[model samples]
Target: MSYELSHLRELEAESIHIFREVASEFERPALMFSGGKDSIVMLRLAEKAFYPCKIPFPVLHVDTGHNFPEVIEFRDRRLAEVGARLIVGSVQERIDSGQLKEEPGANPSRNQLQTPVLLESIEEYEFDALFGGARRDEEKARAKERVYSFRDDFGQWDPKNQRPELWSLYNGRIRKGEHIRVFPISNWTELDIWQYIEAEKVEIPQIYYSHQREVVERDGMLIATGPFNTLGENEKAFTETVRYRTIGCMTVTGAVESDADTIDKVIAEVAGTRITERGATRADDRVSEAAMEDRKKEGYF
Candidate 1:
């Protein structure tokens, strides 16, 4: 057979092209980095994309203040290694200032509260573009987004009003108050990301691998232990071997029991999994049918 680029190679090249285009075009841009696998992989691609020249943008983190320790540590270390500046958008600040009302319960997810903080941060920085490491195959709403998605001055996205972009040409045109949300690896699936992590030898958080953690079963998903959330009345927490499929605030995110200690194994696990990543772990998304879509309209990442 004739020579052809592997899917991983093709994805890497595509991300690199998009990164270069963003760097060349946008004046004030920021990356939404949550220290999750997707964001980690995106950072790695950026390093390769702008090799010789350091990354031209800073990473913005909308911290729910309920993140796993491993994830936060990994985030700090990775940013240090790449020498990229980090800007944190804290949900606690919003709560303390009475901007967002905290949910009253033993278990509460700050996922919904992050929208206002993220939008405020974007406005504070006057960012003309924001690069988010969101994948299409992860969720249904994401599938509807264009490569270069546009948001209005109010930070709302109208799916029906999306510009018609043909060929390789992405329309980044926007008004003064509006901005573009770029997803370089929009077409990549969960399996593809893990495969790339394996092939590229990128370092991810230790929680991705199987480990012992205090967990409780809630609505068919394993909710992992962390600060800022408590156990349910009938539901009791216990230690078990588990790993996070997707990483975010501990309140909203869940884990899966897998023996995937290495990247190769993780890729295999993802390839065989039946449920979508978000469907399995994201409690925020489980809130409503149009949750993610609604959040995107309200300036959530």
Candidate 2:
């Protein structure tokens, strides 16, 4: 008897193949983990990629110092469970050292500042290849990114000069001071991710589920009330049932009104949703039409 792989299994197999390829080809590589749903899924794939043997590469997180507390707690617990080494690049450290200047305003965002810190970390650790859980379906800029994206010596991405991937063959070649950003799940969609999570019983941060929280509406988005975000003079906080569609710096990542508290329910909601996750919740992306593209060119992961 012969059997064919399901679509999720095919995606899993391809990601595992990519993980093994990076481990074999790059002298030093790391997974860019943010304790978010996508990164958690990537970690699960990495675990399966090298089962019976510990994951060979360290996990890198560029700390914006404005992340949700629950996510951070979950990040530590999950890392410990998998026994993966953690390497953190502190944005606050850079700010203190005058390497990065914090944006001024009542609600300052460290999202844009993450690029320089991430680049600094890559340079500091001499990582040749970095795995990111960025899906093409999330944003327009990411949609144009290759599975194996090459960055120049300055850690800048030139979309016009990207290498062509023919027949699933990726070119991981990079010179000294340059590196490649690998997105193993580049083809997976939000619905696919939720489906995989449900099927595999993967654990994720609780913030992804619906819960009652204090939120204030700003520019037509629901901003969670927290230390990272302060209410404007005209803004007033109210209680609502909300869940995060995407996770990032707490200041800029918004929550959507929903009651999808379980994996199955979340999957159902994702399937019926028309707006992309990032477009719905990420305030930082709303800065301009090409915000993500601009950041990608500047080495933001």
Q: For residues 46-139, could you state the per-residue lDDT of candidate 2 as single tens digits?
A: 9999998999999999999998999999999999999999999999898998989999888888988898889989989999999999999888
RMSD of each: 1.4, 1.0
Consecutive 10-residue window with the lowest summed lDDT within model 2: 166-175
* Residues 1-301 of candidate 1: C-alpha lDDT, one tens digit per residue: 9789989998888889888888888888898999999999999988888998889999999999888888899999999999999999999888888888988777777887887888889889999899999999877888989889898988888888888867667777777889999999898988889888888789999999988889888878888755665777788888888888999788778889888777777878888889888888888788889888888877777
Clashes of each: 0, 0
Best by TM-score: 2
Best-fitting candidate, scored by lDDT:
2
| lDDT, residue 186, candidate 2 | 96
**TM per prediction:** 0.96, 0.98
